[model samples]
Target chain A: MCGIVGLLVKTPALKARLGELMVPMLIGMTERGPDSAGLAVFTEPLATDERKISLYSGLTEEGADFNWLGLGHELKAHLGIEARMAVQGNHAVLTIGIAPEPVKRWIKEHHPRLHILSTGRAIDLYKDIGTPTEVAERYDFKHLTGTHLVGHTRMATESAVTPDRAHPFTAGEDFCLVHNGSLSNPYGVRRMLEPRGIKFETDNDTEAACRFLEWRLREGDDLETALQKGFAELDGFYTFLMGTTDKLALIRDPFACKPAVVAENDEYVAIASEFRSLAHLPDIKNAKVFEPAPEEMYVWTA
Target chain B: MDSLKFDLAEIPLRTVNTFLHQEAPGQGVRKVLITNPDGAHNIAVGLDFPVEIEIVGHAGYYAGGMNKQASITVTGSAGTGVAENMMSGRVHVKGFASNGAGASAHGGLLVIEGDAGLRCGISLKGGDIVVGGSVGSFSAFMAQAGRMVICGDAGDALGDSLYEAVLYVKGSIKSLGADARIEPMAEADLATVKALLAAAGPAFDQYAPQDFKRVASARSLYHWNADANQEY
Candidate 1:
């Protein structure tokens, strides 16, 4: 079991206050999930010549003050590309004036202990094992500014309670997902994706779903088509909230076992496992609140 | 009569549910008014005593689930699995309900004033369900015993693989399940419908007892045969 909250700000004026509005939404679901929490925020895109890679370093013995500056120097030497780095909590965002693919390969070979949580022009991912409130504060979520965000609080029903096992699992560039229910045939899906060169960091079912969507997008299917195919291929009860650079998409399984409520206003579109998480939003009384039907996909774009 | 009012905006749902769970019957409080529910799941589950719980706004999944003797009422729409596995007492929803309402309930009365979503009475044992509006597809599937009355149209595959239970629909049925078929209404059937309508309150006053059509199991597939297995 887990709780998922997503917000897509339609009004550009409210973009900078995304994190302030999202804090309560994430904390409201603390009772549903208390093990760990993760969030993915999409802010302004990087310059066309640059890319950003968010990496988690808690696994290192150095803890939160790990040598990110030294790592940046090493990357510059190893790849012969200039890079800048900023450390927040246990995560470090590295912006490099180079393509992302080779940089990702360099990191995989050099720093196997570091986990690349996200890599995109706009997305920054942070996750840790703590209460939603604690994790949100630790990452300075209230001060973070973004156009859209996806967050999750996990209960650890199927996987160990570790940072990597936490949700908002990233797929393609600037694409991430948070799931509420367990998948039945994740191992089978993993086996299918492994041979296609899709790497997995954890044995969690949501990772398999994330990788599947990435593979589908790689195969030239749009997000809507991939989700429609997922309903036929994936066997489980799930409510998935997926995020991309421009869109926030939601879909539920045919049975619709998990609870989900969506509220939309002229300012923003919000989704959560329950309405209580959304009740405190601005102009909520005027927002349209409705439960998304089974096998239906709803999308909000920025 | 003593009544207590709780505003969910001022308190957490867990705290309110804990208080409701600890309260004993006939101790003093006979009614509870919960305001600003705002679609929180599992509002009043496992309630065994005879008390009245009136929720002022929309409720989330599993509202009043596993109810025994409590009479719970929702002023707005209810999420999935309302009154699920209920053993006794009553649950009333003033607005629409999501899927699996009253699923696997053994005994009780669940009344929905508006439309019910898919699989409304799946695996019902003995509970009596009344829907004022249309019910979605695959309702009453694998129902062992119970009674379901739908005042509006019924969606596809109504009463699939049903046994012993009786279904009464005042409007059209999209289709019947494999082992279920329509039956002739008798004097006792009219009496049953009339009593169920009365129990549902005055909203159903215009529905005459004769308006319902009875549906039951065909009994042809009771014992599985090698040839019959091919059809499945």
Candidate 2:
């Protein structure tokens, strides 16, 4: 039972303050998923204009010094990523849907540890396994600034513990997902998706939903349409939160068995796995907190 | 015992938790009067003391779960799994109780003034539950070793696949399960109910002894399997 939390704003105001708000909510739910924690922030004012770029890099295991900012500059010099940004962590991110699969192939072929967190400017997300506080400290996330963000604290049950196995899984451009329940029919769905040139990096069931939603979105379905299709096709007890660069969506499985609460005010909208998470916010004292309806998808667009 | 009266409407009940790790020393036998506690769940959930917590209104699930020695009494109805897995002490509900009232209880006593719902003592190992009114079906579904006394009517399959628990129903049973059977009310059983009621306070005198019947697990499922026709 991994705990996930996220916020989507109609306007991007607070940068590091958003991660600060999400970090406590993630830590409060340590009992649910004590493994690891990670968060991704999407900020405004990109350096490029044509295509979006997402990068994932970690310094510890790589024996690399503080040259990540320079690496972003170097990658832009060669492959020409339109908008370049790096989410601070021990893992590398990728920008998919670029002109050349060979560039993505070349990056992974050279550095096997860094996987694609997200591609295109559609979404920027991050997730890993560990305590929320520890992960926040490890990534120096207090300095991070963004308008939209999502996070996960993992309690491994079905899959082994690894960075790649953590959430929020990136399937394609502008498509990122986070989940909170067990998917009963993961194998059945995986078998169907894998044959269609869709690749998988982890065995977690949540990645199935991520991949499915991404495939539909790329096929020209809107976010809500893809999510409704996800609710209908998926079977299990789940209450998940997903985001794009412009919108935030909350989804519950058919039965609504897992715990979830949503609070909306004029300033921002927030979703968490428990009431305690939302109750801690000062402005949200009178916030109307309620569970998502069965097989329901509650989406908010910025 | 010093009485501390709280209307609960004045206090932010969500932040008031009597956790084991957060207890102040030498609190003594404090009597708390929680008035107008409308559906506050998990009130004093894991209290590990001898304080008496009297809630004057209705409560939701697991009001006094994992209780060690404190005595908690609710003036109104209780939701499912009330006093669930209580280790010791007493929980008395003045009104009816919901399903799984004392499910998986190891010790202590639960007295319900009115009827109790299904699976009342589903996995009761020890302790004693005395219901003044009727009980729903599957009252003692998987009871291990406990005492359940229902003064009013009991529903179907009263003690299905029970272990060593003793069930006493004062009224008629709709139908018995595989190994549960009605037995005569002996001197020892009557005294046990009388003493347990005395401890639960003033709500237990409504039912007469003659209206009740005693039922205990046959212990057949403990060592013998009927289908296998073998003894372990």
User: Who wins the lDDT comparison?
Assistant: 1
In order, candidate lDDTs are: 0.89, 0.72
| Predicted complex 1: CAPRI docking category | acceptable
lDDT of 1 at B108: 92
Q: What is the per-residue lDDT of model 1 for residues B1-232, given as tens digits with 9 covering 90 to 100?
A: 4788889879998888887788545466789999988878899898888889999978888999999999999988888899999999999999888889999999999999988988999999999999999998899998989899999998889999999889999999989987989999999999999999999999989899899999999977798777654853
Which prediction has the highest DockQ against the true structure?
1
Docking class of 2: incorrect
The residue ranges of model 2 lying beyond 4 angstroms of the native Cα positions read A9-16, A45-48, A58-103, B1-43, B46-63, B66-232
lDDT (10s digit) by residue, model 2, range A135-231: 7777766665667777778887778877677777777656577788889888888998989999888888888888888888888998889988887
Off by over 4 Å in 1: B1-3, B11-31, B40-52, B66-70, B87-89, B114-118, B132-138, B151-157, B169-178, B182-214, B224-232
lDDT of 1 by residue, A115-149 (tens): 89999999999999999999999888887788999
lDDT of 2 by residue, B40-136 (tens): 5677687777778898766666878888888889977676688899999989898777668888889999988877866789889897888888887
